[model samples]
Target: MSWAIIQQSLPMFGKGFELTLWLSFVGIIGSIVVGLICSLVQYFRVPVFRQIASVYVEISRNTPLLIQLFFLYYAFPVLGIKFGAQLCGIIGLIFLGGSYMAEGFTGGFNGVSKSQVESGKAIGLSRWQLARYVVFPQGFSLSVPAMAANVIFLIKETSIFTVIAIPELTNTALDLIGMYYRSNEYLFVLVIAYAIILVPLSIILTLLEKRVRYGTFGN
Candidate 1:
């Protein structure tokens, strides 16, 4: 409960939090892109790509992210293939989040009404035109809640990067605990830091969802 120690360690926590934010941002974007592409192909029933997307989602979803990170960071090194710890952590998050995102997006795509699609076809919309103009916007709108939940989960999961010494928030907290021998203080800080970041994000997503539900993207 030493305020002084906590104050001094603020810089360290800031650095770790910055890295965590960077990882989360990049991971979210990568996951969304990967998920959207995978969902789209599977939704359209594209030949080989659809199968590949299925396998990717199945394997990524079934496996523990910890094991995936271990394989990439540890096992790969043994085979003379290597990635930096941060890179491996980012890649693991992307794969894991992308799997969940794919499922969410696929559900969203299915939620679109069949008659709307038929109407698009009757209007002579090309397949790409149908998807781009009519389907993706509505599908993405439907997916927003699930997508927000997945993003929050992915941000929290960034704590696991500590296992690979990625120096995210948890790792910084651990370091402070070792230095000050006050685990409770640092743990409190960790909780506050996460709350600070996640609470606002959750609120913003909620507002966005409401806007989407009302057919307004917002001002």
Candidate 2:
């Protein structure tokens, strides 16, 4: 591990880090939105949408993110649908992450007490009102730990974006190693770079989980 090589490579890694952060941020938000909608559809057992959401969750969760990215970046263009590398990476992350998030959220939604749901209905609360006043709050609280895990998972998944030519952390490290043949130095930095982003994120998520747990259960 040459310190000089590590130091020299910081600028390239910085750019890659920024791109990775951007991709992860966008992917996380998009996945959460998609997941919430799907979970709600499933939870409410919406006629056609419930089946669609179920099939979508199965397909997205079963498929690999790399394959998704390949289809978006390579195969789509053959049919006149075109997406840039970055866009493909973002879409791939959202496509993959959304399924997992949906499952997590569904589990949370299902954990809501049946009696409480009945009570809400007994009070003449409509489906939307029950969802807003009774279900979503408790469900979201129950799902926080799982959601945090998914966020970290999605962030780590950004490493594979390199295959789609996204200039993210892993790509920058690989490029430097190819040019300088300093695999140890570059790889060391790559690991550290990821740690820099994920470690604090994990800690923060842990704290958030504890807070939510305390707030929800009074424990």
lDDT of 1: 0.92
Give per-residue CA lDDT, model 2, range 83-162, as digits (tens): 98998999899999989999999988888899989999999999999999998898999999899999999999999998
True-vs-predicted CA distance for residue 70, candidate 2, Å: 0.9
Q: Model 2, 118: alpha-carbon shift in Å?
A: 2.5
1-219: candidate 1 lDDT, tens digit per residue: 888878888898899989999999999999998998899889899999999999999999999889999999999999999999999999999999998999999988788889989999999999999988878888888999999999999999999999999999999999778877889889988999999899999999998889898865323
Q: Estimate each model's TM-score.
A: 0.94, 0.96
Candidate 2 contains a number of clashing pairs equal to 0
User: What's the lDDT for candidate 2?
Assistant: 0.93
Off by over 4 Å in 2: 216-219
Worst 10 contiguous positions by lDDT, candidate 1: 210-219
What are the per-model C-alpha RMSD values against the true structure?
2.1, 1.2
- Runs in model 1 deviating more than 4 A are 217-219
183: Cα error in model 1, Å: 0.6
